[model samples]
Target chain A: MRGGDAGFDEFVRERYDQLLRYAIMLTGRRWDAEEIVQEALLRCLRRWRRVPADNAVAYVRKAIYHEFLRVARRKPQVPLDELAEQLDLEDFAPAVVARDHVLVVLQQLPPRQRAAVLARVVLDLSEAQTAVELDCSVGTVKSLTSRGMARIRQLWAAEQAAAPGRRGT
Target chain B: MIAEEQEYATRLREELADVAVRASAGQVDTVLRQVHRRRRDRRNQRIQVFTAMAVVALAVAGAFAVTTAGEHAEPARQVDATTPMAQWPARGELAADKDLVARAEQAWHSYRQPPRGPLKPLFAGVSPNMSANMVVVALIAPESGQVAFVTTPIRVNRPSDPRDRLLVRAVAPVTPEQRGVGFMASRPLPEDEPPIDQNAVGMALTSPAAENGKVYTSTIDSQSEPSWPTTVVGALWPQYEMGAGAWNSELRVQFRGAASTEDYTLVTGVSDDVDLGPVALRRAGAALRAEGPGVRQGDLIITPNGVVGVVAAPDGTVDTRLSELAAHGTVGVAISRVPGRVREVGDHAEFTATGPGDFGEEQRLVLQAWDEPRLALTFAKLAGYEPHWLVARTAGPDAAENVLRLGKPGAAKP
Candidate 1:
């Protein structure tokens, strides 16, 4: 194996699950999340030799976010077909009681809102860092997270009202 | 409300932490396979382009020998190409050398996009053979509704090499002034067009030596809309499927005195060193011409995707003013046959301009500026609208200048 290939392969194996979970949080669908992570890793591989060893995980993480945003920007029809399969099979399964309520609720928000909320709440990025990651103004980040949090809260409340016996925090 | 929001935020993070989704088994191998496939595809594409260029170079060599062999030799009835060189008097330092001009014309016809067009040879000039014999031809492609200038390297007595052929120096929609200039030539601008005698500026055909390496940057006072500047730069066409980045889809042209090889394409085309962004050129829409009092007089570009707009600013900045005018109410495609109407784009529509900052030369700066079509696609994707690639025509010259107004399901034409 080429010197870089060994490192890249090892890196992918070690970080794949962590990256997949982060992608799922952003995309709200396992299929879309996998696609996003795969594309991001492929792009990262192109510059793998240059990525700082200590920061490779962060680099791949940022790449995943950017890839998700790019896919969202394209709004391509091909993925919506894949999305249909994901929705039918996994997202709305009878095991909704087992899935995280927040993950279920995140599907209702727009891509930017979800990204903003994830950056602020889950990744624990400050408003400025979120702005830089999302490529928007800090004020825009603030607005997106605020609106996103509100929607998630509303959805969580409605879901609790609908299925009082389901999982809730 | 604030306390509740913070509580929700905290719980959300906690829930996310509990969420776990693993990659499908052997997913790493799948991605590696895809990576290899993409690399193979890119290599194959480059080989195809190289093969085509090699064919063009070989063709140019044979044509040069045939043209120089006999002056009176009836120009072999040309097939599926621009106008034959026999029609125009060769007018440069190499004017005495008919063979050079003829070879340049042949090379240009070989390299031009949408090759079959009724041609009007505007100017032909040759610089004394440098590292390679350089020849430039400016002409009109009526079938495609564009005026273009192409540069090709001719190897007079050497073996054909694909690297020698430099194609598409400049091709843009013929502006009103060029239309008038073109009309002055034997072929008048197509009869259906309105008369533009007032805008026609007489053409000046200069020697290639005079223009060699001289850069002319047109200055626009930041305060006002520039009057017809010397060089007519327009965002020609965006080739989306060609590659991943907006760079592939976008071609910026300075079709006048600004013609030089120092543009973005020259830099990006030759070198694979510069990494590109993942943004794709999604769509090239129908031709939308903005004309009326106050409309920035420019060319009517006909791209494979569609006739987008006349990017007439000398700086090659798209006049968003036309769209901003339509934002108030009126919206429709200007071309009568293409049926579409947009009521209000509201917050969903916007024309975002990205500039390549401080690139020194205006041409480089111009080429890097994102044009309307790419903007339309980007905006459509970001706004979550199904991007219908059509630019709105300014309803009347009365709408505000420099704003973009697009329709929701349709595009805005004023």
Candidate 2:
């Protein structure tokens, strides 16, 4: 289908959520991730005719990734402080706390390392496939994942110890 | 270590397994509307480009005729010291792009001004790379002596002509003293030194041995570049990668206020822009509101749950604070019950904190204080047998006064 064709809307409707989740991983902010997804969808919609029918998701995902990188490049100021919302430690279950802690640790990784870890562990892609996605060498993928995993382990341990009741428990 | 890493990976996978976000009700309609607007903008830009080319052609032809008649051709336009900056003619490589100028003007009008009235285009630069083509526009309101810089990513629809997508990233206010000069640094260079002279547009060189360490800051007087307008914008292009020897380095430009020549410094990092990922902090909706003007670095706002650090914006205004912080900012607050004590031991200090279960006596943390007020916790290790190490402890002070004292030996409690 051409740009703005009937099939285009259907494709977007079906894959919007998946695209958003991936963007969230890339951007970290829901507002930014949503904006990125919308921007990517528009870009893909414009060139729908060229996108491969067999791999429409991959094409759109690539567009989202590039858009995130583009937005990142344009923003070249000092790093802002991330404000952690007040949370009652006693209010949550152990599972909820564990999930939240891991997610928090993921944010501490650099973009390339985050991407590598997500591809390898989350998506379960082979090293070669991960390299193809990241557009880097397989060796670079290995390096990124290794460094990423190491950082995550260190961060997870620190956060666990820091959490009030979790340490003694 | 391997088993712990695997455990963390397993948890990460489980945490993100069901991550999903539903598209908003009008997402499709919004995108379609944007697509139509983009098409219309491209058509209008083409017309504007043609009209500009014709006008330029006529001016050049007219100037040639005057020169041929044995008379000196008059300068197209001249500005005297008496003329206000807003009335000054637009000048820059991208000043000729009428569509961009119009978009910049529109953004400038809509953005929150800093006591400055109307601003006119001063200078612009387009930094094109494989990833994105970014155009940075500097607009100045001379009477108020304040300048605002707008950066937008342009999409080149056609190979020959570049069109403005008009998705203005941010319009940031630059003090008159800063003259709107900024730097865009690329990733660190490789170990093998490449020739800089061939591909360099501008260069900022600082030695590792310099008192400032990795971060190198310098002020270039706008008065020196008389022909280059008060605001000079330059980029350390992507192709000429800066040496990685200065790990996590920053390039700061000192702006001597245009009106009174007072020194004003802006600190910007030369690294990847970090975004707030989905976490309890962001999910619970921890929003940033400027406490007040002139919130200094390391200033903490104590809350019921934890501490919030105030990031210093170049100007004290809330608008500029949010705008600049949107790019790259760091705010880390750690409140731990584990008491950690640090005492100086020669050049480096040793920290003793409570250790966990199987770990022996005390967790010894060897810390180094960088020139900056920030304490660089070198590493934390278990003292006795089978020593396990924790590297790069970047958390904000848990033991506030002690941590501060570790970095600054004679510092009083905050």
Candidate 3:
């Protein structure tokens, strides 16, 4: 499935939502996640003429994840002033206030471990498939997901104990 | 799947569904527009570069130094350097095949040339590893200085030449020392010990390191010469064990741009090629592609190289998630409510309990001024103790809600 611009654009139209969601999970902030996806799509379009259709989806998915990783790797985050500057750029962000108890805990996990749990347990990707995506061994995926889940449970319990004691993952 | 995993998924689905980020149709439209505009701007910059070079060509200029990656490097075909980057047709994604094989396949397709015309590839099998400073074949668009024939980022690894596969078909496992553990009390060499001399053989992997020093299972053809260093180094973090000590420790697997090795040791198998060849590369690619660029933020990918590494491509993605986490990364997980600012350290910090009668056995302390949420209330005490054993009294009122840690702090995330 080589991707021509038409096909590539079509791909973007279909998966933009899912990609955005994945990016948001990868990056805690929405605008940054959106930016990452857009950049990935652009990279895809740049090579649309050459991208194999079979590989385009994987390519973009890789690009999105990589983009998030790259952004996450950037040194000491922008100061609070810069954060405000970015927040001010959003024209209308009504959902910004809707914070989740689980996401707060999720944010605390090692980025890769967090990604493992999401890709494996939540998304139900096979361990082998998840390993391919994570560029690790089956054992690593097992270890990461296991540790990640345990941490999630601990964090969830902690969050619940602090607040309303809601049952957690 | 385990019951815990099932339970986690159920809880996760419910929570994430309730809070997954979303965007409006307008926002999506804007993204599409902006990204395409950026692509166009990039092409336009290439065109501008060509124009600038042409203008410089007209002006007085000194002879330039020729930069080359290899001693016998060949020059690319020179063009007028006046063409726009967009004019040159972009050949699509490169497949996993080598130059000779691609040529062979191209020749095979000669008679089957698409009904359209003679199948002329602008070029074939551009190495995924090539970049600006070290391009194998330079195709600067006419005069624009824009790279017309950009190299692919994915290396080409074709199937083995059957004869070569027969060379070491009966390969056995490596040793425990190579596995980094069985021999010593610990697998990792003590931090005090000097590092191994990686350049023993002169191979890039054996050398200090390469950009993104990722090791994949590789084999170097053994040399009869006495000067030849052993291809088998200690095992670094590898995709799988070929046996023990087949490769060097993970710290020894050096790559350029790679800060830390992911422990994927590239085994130096006995092979026809002196260094990593098609077979090893194909295996590496397969393994890497299978392992998704080892989860960036959390997406799994397969590549010896990180998708977004410490060094990013010019204008590539720049993630700030981890850095932000590093800033305000922790919290007081085990503590009860804010027991004021208990300034203390070690496995446990004893705070004066004004509320021993007010609170239960468990107690908490929150600190201020840090982004990390990990400032856990670290303390352990017997159940029926009376008040008076308090070491430090947390003085401030709202300061209890701030950031602080009490206990032997566990290693924080990088």
Q: Which model scores highest in DockQ?
A: 1
Interface RMSD of 3: 12.3
lDDT of 1 by residue, B214-280 (tens): 1111111011121221221110111111111212222222323654332221112211222222111
Retained true contacts (fraction), each candidate: 0.41, 0.36, 0.38
Error of 2 at A105 (Å): 1.9
Instruction: Show model 1 residue runs off by greater than 4 Å.
Output: A1-6, A76-101, A167-169, B66-414
Segments in model 3 whose C-alpha atoms lie over 4 Å from true places: A75-99, B20-22, B58-414
State the lDDT of candidate 3 residue by residue for A1-169, as single tens digits: 4535667656776777778777766665565777799888887788788877765666677678777777778845544445444333222243443443455566677778988888886566898878877778999999988898888777777767887646533
TM-score of chain A of each: 0.75, 0.77, 0.79
Candidate lDDT (C-alpha), each = 0.43, 0.43, 0.38
Candidate 2, fnat value?
A: 0.36
TM-score of each: 0.37, 0.36, 0.37
Q: lDDT per residue, candidate 1, A1-169, as tens digits?
A: 2345458877887888788778877776665777798888888887787888887877888899899989878864335445434544331122212334456577668888998998898888899888977889999998999999989878888878999987666
Quantify how close model 2 is to the true structure by its C-alpha RMSD in Å. 19.6
lDDT of 3 by residue, B283-385 (tens): 2321221111221222111111111111111221222111121122232212222223222345333444322112223232222113322111122232222
Q: Per-residue lDDT for B279-392 in model 2, tens only?
A: 111111233333333243333222111222223332211121211211222211111112244333443333334321111223322221222212212223333322222222
Compare candidates 2 and 3 on TM-score and give the better one.
3
